[model samples]
Target: MTIKIAQISCGTEYSGIQSEIENAAATVGGKMVYPDVSYEEITRAVDDFGFDPVSPQLKLMIARAKALADGHYDADAVFIASCFRCAEGALVRNEVRRYLQEHARLPVVTYSFTERLKAAQLLTRMEALVTIVAKKELLARERQVGLTAGIDSGSSTTKAMILRDNEIIGKSWTPTGEVIGSAQEVLDEALEEAGVKFNDLEGIGVTGYGRFLIGRKLDANLIQEELTTNSKGAVWLADRQRGEATIIDIGGMDNKAITVRDGIPDNFTMGGICAGASGRFLEMVSKRLRVEITELGALADKGDWSKVNMNSYCSVFGIQDLVTSLAAGHTIEDVAAAACHSVAEQVYEQQLQEIDVRRPIIQVGGTSLISGLVTAVGEMVGSEPIVPENSQYIGAAGGALLSSGFLEGQ
Candidate 1:
């Protein structure tokens, strides 16, 4: 089925990224349609929304959202977007998102775009939105019922997990090299550890940056983007699938903040302004400090962040600050602590603002294994985050869990 995703935005034509957005949706079996509204309806919608914007384009955007909410148009999902350069456009964009989420109850993804936006940049978000609308029942399944294997081919690392009847029996994590090679290596290792041959697996799922390439190579049953998979894995791991929760995944190249209800994502945001706020920054800190990345977490736990002034938003400048702190005779522990704190603070400032953060914030992804980073996130969020067992394998676990729904006779 071709899911119809409604496009609500302003300046896409002027910005020249409209086709890119449509291409992204179409790449995942979705058709982007605009909600038709008359000028009289636009005027009425502006009054009903109670926020009048000066621009006529903004007025039309409001009317389109209203039309969708009022069932004047048929749509399986909503994509709200606006040029990042416009402050007023952003306000209208967010308000429209919240309004439709409350009234229309459809899957929505919002984007702040630049003229440089490309179809590749929007593919993951579009794919996830399509998956939510098309595979609603698959996402709702709570448990793994058969032997399944999952591979997460991430930017920095590749991980694989094998699950049997709701239990993770084996897994492997390794630095990512050639996408397919890394995925194959981990799958072999995980199968070895699980003492199961490939023929025994009932289903196989794949996710992360290299999902499409590796998924095709492996003939995956479920080739999904990480946003939906991660949330599914997170709630399942944290045992919070039955209620409202927030999921934070501070990944290698980017970050994701998701607000989910009953294990399914209603709204989510991904990407960061810089690598300084991501796990890649911490890896540089570890290299500079001459300690293993795993050891940096323990060292950071013993130090004080206040002792060092490493407050650069760019990863390159952040590393320069790290070197400066070290040259200034600051302890390595303090520098590690400062690095962790900086990333946590940036995540809060950049991505957390995009969603209504519900309680029991579950932090997942490889970064969740860093005790210092996890602690810093807890301090920033005003509550300790729940990092579940096998948290580092969230993407893999999510794939395995979701793929189980495709098992024979399931």
Candidate 2:
């Protein structure tokens, strides 16, 4: 039976749950709906779940969890995915089971956000990790796929990638802490890297933290939601027919999860105005370790991680967890893999089963570029995480493809 599911997470600051749920629903031939809420709001909402004049924070958290299942996500079932259930989870669990006993209407199946995360971390240690589809697959997806340039100018860097024929022709990443100057320079650099002059390209789409401010003057102003661009960019060369899959784009600022099912956008969600479970958090941690972001991926390839002791909800605490692990003689690879697991756990806890969705989830964005992330997420979806060749180009490619109205044509 095709289930209509509402997938929710308690306090995920990232984007994995929603889109992954959408993908999960699609894979299982289910229908999914997304009710958007920021992670902070979710965490706070749990506070009120036990609104029967509950006492103490822990009891209140439990009451709130129960109340939430009773009130907000009144679907057939509630998917309780939280890294740490806290007192809130216990209460939520009690309410769900109680409701089931009294009403006996629908069943509530709980998936541990932490377990999914650990599985992802474990997969990072595999010696024969699945290699991403080769470049030829990307190029073969579409003939004469329009070439476009996506430039993400950030506080510390300007990144531009060229997408053509479903393949990334070239990319340019240069430090431009100042968004203004690098905006102009990176365009030229990206065009050069693609080996194509500006006039030859069909479109140029811009995104990211500095996308709007920078891309306007270039007369190349195709502004898109960072999440959609990120997710679609990641799916540019996937095997889903008619683009039937959800895209999970977890980035520096927040997570943006999009549900593109039945070859149409069913729903999309984003974290609002918070740096919780963000790419910036990872970037900060990487900086603290004096490591490059690219290097972090290769580091996760080593099979050494066994324990990750993350106790904090915030990234700062997460970094501290990393520090503690290092002090305990954890290898760099283990630490990085654990970091990815922590992130996945946070995301899963916040967004899973609030809406029931499908599988074959396509995980994308800078974090998705991490080997550990893809592996961890794959286990979360009960399937291999789909990362396209030129995984980095998914956003750019999606923007370009969407700009051409490719879906409309198909």
Candidate 3:
């Protein structure tokens, strides 16, 4: 039972806990190999692996890969450490889990230390992670069953996901026009891609702004709260550890600040649908600036935001501010960056004022795809936000998880 751990950390702020880990490792009959890895080594690996260098947070991930690959820290398991509120820590931890599982063929565990946690709780989580890793062989084997479908019908788009034995087999989405038509279309597309029929689905779940339409039209077996669906989907996809996380879901016309505790909604706040903080606001500004929404993030990144400002109260005024800033000799990039800041401000000041946003913040929805907005939100929150892959389709993913659970129960 003496487990040897090759440990990597995101920072030295929690170095005080090193002794605690040592004590706990000894108690559990394990030893840790925490080599003092350099940033230069991490940067080299990042370049070698072709990871995006612009984001400083990626250093954590690159460093992890480098540590695992290097022959110095040879061990039976890997231990990753980061603060609970550290966005880089959360993202890197999740990525490393997959990497170690596939490439290294080793068990990995992450310890998310928080100042708010009592010593007992912190030790408990660490012990639990170690136990989970130790029991990977037993937990890895899961029962496979029939296919399940989850459909998300939002105000601006519809998405569908097909899950077979808890693995995603197919996913598809389309712009929303008529609710039922869009829902049916995406569902059909996903099913076709998965080579399955509607009748073959053991259970179906639906969620989103227009989820009511789908529930009424399709008679979905499960109709969940949009916030619940968002949190469930985001938590599932991110593979976050136990405890709570903040979710910023920016949809077409609405935005939600959801607090998910143990993969369930603890609390939430919804921003006004007509506010300038939503994706529609971004689209409006992008159109006025004669730039594609996809290009807005890059443009904003290039701009000097030191002198830029924009109205955050209303979309109309926000667009007007963007136009005025451009006419006053400010570059379009500057205006675009300011627009991104304005959206973040609107969410932070107007919507998130009521909710206690705990990190690691998982940002989802189409607007979150904008790199600039993500950066702005991170700056405003004083913490980096974790943007997962295929975030916009999290609602559909959440529904799929719910439907899959339902099928398993049957």
Candidate 4:
């Protein structure tokens, strides 16, 4: 069944990414539908929203959102978008998203697009919305009941995990190269460690950048986007699955901040404004400090970030700041702490502002293993983040947990 996704947007046609948006939805077994609203309805919606925007396009956007909220449209999910350049559009997009969440009670995602926006960029968001609609029960499941294996084929690393009756028995993490081969290697390692044959697995799930390709190759039972999966895994790992919590995943190529309720993501924002806010920047900083990435965390814990100035928002400039700091006689530990702090601050400015952050903030992903980065995030959020056991395997664990929901039918 193709999930009907409502497209409530301001300028996709003018920006020349409307087709890209449609194609993304189609690729993920979703059909984009425009909610119909008359001009009178648009006027009424603007009046009811109590903030009339100067742009007529934003007025129409509000009308469509109102129509959805009032049950005048039938949609499984909602996708609200506007051009990045439009401040008014951004305001309307965020308001519409909240409106739908409150009144429509539907799964929703909002994006600020550019003319260069490609379907690849929107695929995960569209896929996640569809997953929330089609696999609601699967995502809501709290525990893994049977033998299941999960593979996370990430941009920089691949990980695999095996779960049996709510316990993770084995897991593997390796640097990613050839996507399929990386996934297979970790799967083999995990299965070997678990002392289980591949055929013994009741269900297999895959996620991350290479999910579609690897899922098709492996015939995965649950091929899902990481937003929902990561939230589920984070909550489950942190033992916060029963309450409202915020999840932060600072990944290799990008970052994700999700607001989840009862283990399911109700709101999420992914992608960074630049690479400087991601794990890749931290990796470069580690190299500049003549330390391994894993060792950078310990080094950062030993120094004060205020001792150096490394506030560049671009990774290249960030590195330049690092070199300048070291040349000025700053210690490597201080430089490392500054780099971590810079990344955390950028994440807060670019992504965290997109949602209402709930507490018992859980930080997951490979970066979470870096105590320095975790500390910086804690400092930025004014709360110490809960880093669960085996946090690095969150994507794989999420896959395994969600896939187990398919076992009953199989």
Residue-level lDDT tens digits of model 4 in 225-263:
899988888888898889889999999998999988888
Candidate 2 ranges with C-alpha deviation above 4 Å: 1-147, 153-158, 163-168, 239-243, 272-276, 301-306, 353-355, 406-410
lDDT of 3 by residue, 66-107 (tens): 667665456666666666566656666556554554466444
What are the Cα lDDT values of the candidates? 0.92, 0.54, 0.71, 0.90
Q: Pick the winner on TM-score between candidates 2 and 4.
A: 4
Best by lDDT: 1
Question: Candidate 2, residues 1-410: lDDT per residue as tens digits?
Answer: 44544443444334244445445544434444444444565456545443332323333334334444455544433343444455554445445444432442333334334323432221111100110111113222332256767776543456677777656687766665678677667778878877899888677777666766766766663655354455445555564535457666666656655555433333344442334466677676677668898777667666344566754368778888889888988778887777766666556555433323456577766677778766655656567777766555455555555444332244
Clashes of 3: 0
Pairs with backbone N, CA or C atoms under 3 Å apart (clashes), candidate 3 = none
Candidate 1's clash total is 0
Higher-ranked by lDDT: 1 or 3: 1
The worst-scoring run of ten residues by lDDT in candidate 2 lies at 124-133
- Each model's number of backbone clashes? 0, 32, 0, 0
Error of 4 at 114 (Å): 0.8
Q: What 10-residue stretch in candidate 3 is worst by lDDT?
A: 135-144
